[model samples]
Target chain A: MSEFDLIRKHLTGIGARRDDVVVDLGDDCAVLRVPHGRELAVSIDTLVAGVHFLPDCDAESLGWKSLAVGLSDLAATGAEPAWATLALTLPAADEAWLAAFCRGFAELAAAQDVRLVGGDLTRGPLTISVQVHGFVPAGHALRRAGARPGDLVCVSGALGDAGLALRHLQRGEPLDDYLRRRLERPVPRVELGELLRGLASAAIDLSDGLVADLGHILAASGCAAWVELDRLPLADQVAGVVAGQAAGGADWGLPLASGDDYELCFTLPPEHAAELSVLAAAARCPITRIGEVVPGSGLRLLTSDGHPWAGTVAGYDHFHG
Target chain B: MSEFDLIRKHLTGIGARRDDVVVDLGDDCAVLRVPHGRELAVSIDTLVAGVHFLPDCDAESLGWKSLAVGLSDLAATGAEPAWATLALTLPAADEAWLAAFCRGFAELAAAQDVRLVGGDLTRGPLTISVQVHGFVPAGHALRRAGARPGDLVCVSGALGDAGLALRHLQRGEPLDDYLRRRLERPVPRVELGELLRGLASAAIDLSDGLVADLGHILAASGCAAWVELDRLPLADQVAGVVAGQAAGGADWGLPLASGDDYELCFTLPPEHAAELSVLAAAARCPITRIGEVVPGSGLRLLTSDGHPWAGTVAGYDHFHG
Candidate 1:
């Protein structure tokens, strides 16, 4: 077992240092020179032991997902990932846990080419808070308020995998490798966000399920949406496991109400909507058009053939949990 | 009881908005436009219940001090306070606790003219993490690695009061108004730091006591410091409480090793050191000379008459605690 400050040795070697980092770790604050003409995009996310993840979740995956959550916010803003700071609180410091945690956190930081400039480690009930700072060109950040009535709603990558994975974990059922990986290590669509900067009118990361998250876009843009339920890109397991397992099994609701997907849900005008296919091919990730923005309030779900649909599932609520 | 997320209803009205805050809270990420020619100074600090503060400490005080800790880092770097984010984890959402917490936190954010941006809330252990973002001109941040031999060491405001207050709390001794205020609400020296930007060659915020915090400066600048113990400006309670109160009660070691002072300890050439008197007068905060930069490594403590000093006390170590 390891018992010491979590940041002392493990996190020292994580992340890729950048030239803009004037001051790094060991100082009171990290001084960064924001590139000229760039605006800073900042977001903070906290993962608790039982609220956000399983109490007995793997330390490595927890570390990775903590940073991934913050980075996903950056992706939603069309910002280029740059620097991050971690505030980690743990009950005890295990040497093995620290090593695995650092490895998981470092791999993602390296992939994004982001630097871990500073952080604080303390003793408390396990809670990890990561604040990510990225840079986007002035006036070019993707936002939730810019979608118009004529815009086409789109989502990148499969959606319900992580939510389905949560069902397994909650039911105490053993998760297969594919579902486990999706739940533990969700991808943050940084490149897709960067590519959609000027093309997409609005964007948001899917942390809550599709209906709730997309509802935010609708509320902010003062519009509504007609979502074709069958158009949702569901995970293989979600489609097969819950497709007809029970009466009114919410086959489509898995995507509509499943949270922690970490995918990009965005909207684009009709002229540029077709370009999403080419962009998806280049990114090697699937981007699906699931709905159309309409002039009204709230969202309407429709079946595969465009008939009206209904559901009673709600989005993830920490309070309820 | 406050059951919903803390950020939703309370924090929205806390701080004044800035023009540079293109997009504030209620988004995936807050978009901030950094003015041209300014670099970003970022710092994160977490306060955990029973670790960083008392388990039953006043909720309002906890909130105010959380933001103060991060702003102190900005002060150390001579950055102008601008924006902040909070990630608070709690076991339960009590409205009374939240109202008091927000009141204390908002007052400080308003006084500093710092905008409260985005944040995350979760259920877990009681911990508050605040990340402050400030701005300074490129290459103008006062860093610990800039001190040179023959520079005078200086500190803004009194020290050891907070440490003494901690002792009182730990020993179950009643605290006087002065001592209790010091412990609960630390004033971050943002003005002093900004004033000393071009004047002080190196600087650091005092959190881990004089010897340990200054030791960071010495190590980073590759120089040693000769600290005059008797010259330190100690609070009335710290001197009386620790001086001769017990066997070998030190008249000075309490301030020397006590942490949580949150004062700005900086260095400047002897030529500009005299101007500290004038600067202190204008700023209305005490700036005292307590040491000098020397050519060597580590810190050397001496009495008022310049005799060699000895001590066994170490700075605040989270691990040791």
Candidate 2:
């Protein structure tokens, strides 16, 4: 059978609401109607093998990671997940691999109420690209330019677990279930973002390490941040790893600069901190106030002693040594 | 500098309208507002190094072709082009190459009034994936399942020129300026599709070979079609290429199944044929009535003598020998 036939027969079973989707899987394009009063938020992320993930990574994890990464972007914008289009490139159409991958992808997508709208499947070295769309009310979406100089910088959940998970995976260390699951399925704080939409000032997702990703908010808002290194919400497992390490001082840089946290980092005025605490309690999610935005142009890390904490600023750079 | 820095410094200046774009480049996601009465049309296309085009294809042409392919989908839905996000993966970030690619990308984007909303630049084998979003009036978008039996099948401009252009490029054939230009720059019938929005029953862009791509309409609409081979609209240069071939028999199939035409193929009711002709004339584009939909399930090709013409299907397929 031809490629078109294969896709029509085997891959078109992914469910999407047929009512609002005028054109579905087999068409050249999918036509969707955004209800009035809603704005569309779209994001695209491409995960290349040996770069974004391990070449030998499980196909199921790869599929889950693909959707998770894209959904993280929607979470950052406080947009409700709606539709997604996947573009998959593989060396060949292995039916077994495709089935496993689709199963994982469908599970995650269904959990988030995201529909698989349409996409292209082709032959190449394994690469997965997903473009996710979300809907947000007009004038209600969060942005990175709304933060003020005196706003408190906050992050959702513990950091450095995903980075440390990578190191564990690389070192072939048998991670405890908590660390392994954190790496495999990092939950994006989508609901928390919605709760904080009108409350938070600037917001961004931590994908390229806390320092670099948070730098985006500072740059966009034309402000600087003073982060208290001691106050970072580190994962218990990561803290255990840090304590067990030999005197390589401040190896916690990975937790600080490691990408793939998929956590939301935002800013709120000092006066809103109490309300934020109440909101976090209601949501049952940890919301950490790590620092405050200041009037400047660059990020500064402060030690508990009120001195600058100088550590390696290295992070994932797409095209560099 | 890294790819991220290069994009921040250079590739970001692609005429992005940042005022209305809630989240522009350098963010996890970009957010934009859809006007009240407009429905969003989204499409994606991925071009791999050796699969979609020649290995050494001009960077500018690659960029233009990538955007053009995605726009063709929007055009088929009669959506007014609005925004595009490009994900570019390169083995290495070459400054000159990126400059040329951005120039070509921005040129076409500006022509269609499509804003460069957001995207990512990553490190991997050369792959350019573009996701485009457009807007159409609510309940006015065209679709592939809207074709009814007895509708007149029509196509815009000529077909098979792009396929032949690729063949010539592969054979290293010395061609006139027109054929070479056809291969490099395909003019998608965006305006013609917009004009046919309310008139055409079912519409699709001819990206794959005419026979195969049109088959999508037939399958979706549950209709059969009888295409008159003699009435096909062929470019003058394509005709010359056919005449130059020693045996026209095999070459005739190239135009039918060779994809990458990027023209609009649509169905219109017989009662609207004359109106469509007038509309096509007003749009300054030729609309050829090459077939008619029938109450059946298979496509048939008829010669002037009314005999079935059996030919090879030559369009690009991801998996098939």
**Tens-digit per-residue lDDT, B1-321, candidate 2:** 866688787667575454557656666677787777777788888888888888899988877888899889988988888888888888887888888888888888888887877778888888888988887888888888888889999998888888788887899987677766677777767788788778899999987778888888899899999998878899877776655763756356667877888889999998897797687887788889999999999788887688887665655687763
Instruction: Write down the worst ten-residue block by lDDT for model 1 chain A.
Output: A1-10
Shift in Å, residue B314, candidate 1: 1.5
Per-residue lDDT for A17-63 in model 2, tens only?
A: 54666656667667787767777788898999888887887777777
Clashing pairs in 2: none
Q: List TM-score per model, in order.
A: 0.95, 0.95
DockQ score for model 1? 0.64
* Candidate 2 segments exceeding 4 Å error: A9-20, B13-20, B243-250
DockQ, all candidates in order: 0.64, 0.70
Query: Fraction of reference contacts reproduced per prediction?
Result: 0.77, 0.72
Runs off by more than 4 Å, candidate 1? A1-8, A249-253, B1-6, B246-253
Residue pairs in clash, model 1: A2-A93, A2-A94, A2-A95
Every prediction's TM-score for the first chain? 0.96, 0.95
